[model samples]
Target: MQFTSEVIIATYNKPDYLRLCLKSIAEQSQRPTSICLADDGSDARIDPVIEAFREAHPDLPLRRSWHEDQGFRKSVALNRAIAGSTCDYLVFLDDDVILHPEALARHFSCATRGRYLTGSLIRLDADLTGRLLEAQSYGWAEGRLAGWTPKGRSQWLKSMPFPSGVMALFDRLSPVAPNFQGACASVWRDDVLRVNGFEGNMSYGGLDKEIGVRLRNAGIRGRHVRYTAPAYHLDHGRSYADQKVKSANRAYILALRKSGETRAVNGIAELDAV
Candidate 1:
């Protein structure tokens, strides 16, 4: 069945990364119904890139929401996008990841009722990321690796594509926990509304997984498409990443896990009122 899907990208002042990310979206085998960019207080430069992209793809529906230059409020940015998105399905992506041609196709193929689909990203080295930023769309397919390109746990595994039959078998037999990764995840819009959307109080770490915890509590199982829906994560220094905030967020998520919380206090519904 063909579901109307919207791609929500969280971006903050990274124009180059956003440019590459937008290019990949334009090249997707299956175009998303719309593109919603949740801009977390980006500068004037980012607007030109957005305008250029809009001019380049006049047919693609693109909308962006922006707030003032506050601290890291990525969850808020995402929630605002959630409030505005009108679609049957929503795909979340960080502006730093470049996707393969089949990434959206793989994601949509895995869409099922009562479940949100999660996929993985192959982290690129600084050198490779630079190379990717310099390369054109025709040259970007190399990011999908045959083996672990950067040598991290399951990076190579996630980057590799498998036959549909083989992947279905492995996904069913796997004993590992299925986690929601924000960089590459898709869900029914109504299911997201059921959970009240992403935790707006979160900072950086485990923000996406926190939503997964709530979704599970709300009885929405996760479908893992890590192997089939591969995207390349561009490596960059996290100026916004705070270990303290991350630890706090992680602890909060664990507490939510114990409490079996199913809805976010400061999420889409709440933000919509403000």
Candidate 2:
């Protein structure tokens, strides 16, 4: 069965990465049902980058959701997209991650009804990221990673996005718990609403994990599709990640775990209440 999907690209002020990110989407073997630019109040600079993507790939369905520059309200922006998206499945991507040609195809295939699929990211050092961002016509980094040096052989292996034919070989148990990673994860729209969507009252850290744990509480288990749907995460400074807020978020999530809370207190439903 073919499931309809929408790709939600969460972005702030990074226009260069956004440009390449969109390019990677454009190169997908299977195009999404639609694409939503989940803009968290970026400046006017990002408009041109978005416009260029639209003009270049006019056939792809695209739209944008924006709120004022109110610090790190990514959860709020994502919730807005989740509320607005018209698709059976939602694939979340960060602005800095570039996709494999078959990434979307893999996600669509792996999206089952009972569970959300979580994919991993191969972190690129800043030097390598800079090199690729500067290089033109190279957003799809599948076979080109041969000469590039990642941390080790294990890390380098992740850069290779295995084609669909060999997927069954790696269907063994996942090493890590299937957690919801923001960069590359897919879930049913119904499941998200069932848990009231992402917690709007959150900071940069632990927000994604909070929703993941909630989904588990709500009986939506997670599946690791890390190897099959792998993507390259670009390295960047985390000036926005405040340590105080990070600690607070960790405490909040721990409370949720202890209480086994499901729905988000300040989520999509709360947004409608105001």
Candidate 3:
């Protein structure tokens, strides 16, 4: 079955990274129906970046949903994007993650009903990320093995194209369970609506995992797409990541998971009811 997909990118004030992200999206082999930029709270600088991208790719549907930059309210911004989207499937990306040309196509091919796909990103070191951003060009393939080295069980799958049979075999036998990394993952729109979207109260840290747990509790399974849909992740400082807040959020998510709570109290439902 063919599924319509939309890419929803959550951003703050990273215009350079966002520009690269959009450029990667523009190069997708199987482009999304639309791109919804979920701006948490950014200044006016992001406007020209989006405008330039729109002018460059007029055929690609792009929409921006912005709110005041009160704090790191990523969940609220994502909730707004989810509420605004009109597609069968939703791919969530971070501002610093640049996709491979085949990333979206692979994700769509691996997509199954009642399940979400969690992919991985190869981290690009500070120097490489800076050079690429400064050059305003994305040579993802050339820099595939630039900063880090891939090891472990699935190391052979890095930056290699496999036949359809191999992809199917890997998708079936892969031992990795679905752990939602907001940087690269895809889920169905109905499933997200079923859980009322993400919890707005969450700050960071286990925020994505909370929704993954809830989705599993609601009977949706997690599919691992680590090598199949790998992307390039631009490295940056995490100055805004508050350890205390993340700890509290993780504890709250654990409590909710233990209680088997599926729907978030202040998620998409609350926003829609308003």
| Highest TM-score scorer | 2
lDDT of 3: 0.84
Native-to-model Cα distance after best TM-score fit, residue 240 in candidate 3, in Å: 1.6
Candidate 3 residue runs with Cα over 4 Å from true position: 140-156, 161-168, 272-274
lDDT of candidate 3 at residue 147, scale 0 to 100 = 43
Clashes of each: 1, 0, 0
For candidate 2, what is the TM-score?
Answer: 0.93
lDDT of 2: 0.84
Instruction: List model 1 lDDT by residue over 1-274, tens digit each.
Output: 9779999999998888999899889989999999999988888989888899999999998999788779888999998988888889999999998887788998888889999988877787887767666653325335453222557646655665456567666666657778889998999999999999998888889999999999999999998887777788887998878899889988898899899899999999788565
Q: What is the C-alpha RMSD of each candidate to the true structure, in Å?
A: 2.2, 1.9, 2.3
Runs of candidate 1 exceeding 4 Å displacement: 135-153, 272-274
lDDT of 2 by residue, 54-164 (tens): 888889988999988988889999999999988999999999988877789888887889899888888888888888777734533355353356688656556554554
Better of 1 and 2 by lDDT: 1
- Say what the RMSD of model 2 is: 1.9
Please provide, for model 3 over 1-274, each residue's C-alpha lDDT reduced to its tens digit, 9 standing for 90 to 100.
Answer: 8778899999989999999999999998889989999999889888899999999999998999888888778988999999999899999999999887888998888778889989766777788888888977866434243444555435546454565456556766767666887889999999999999999988868888889999998989888777667687898998879999988987897788789889988898787553
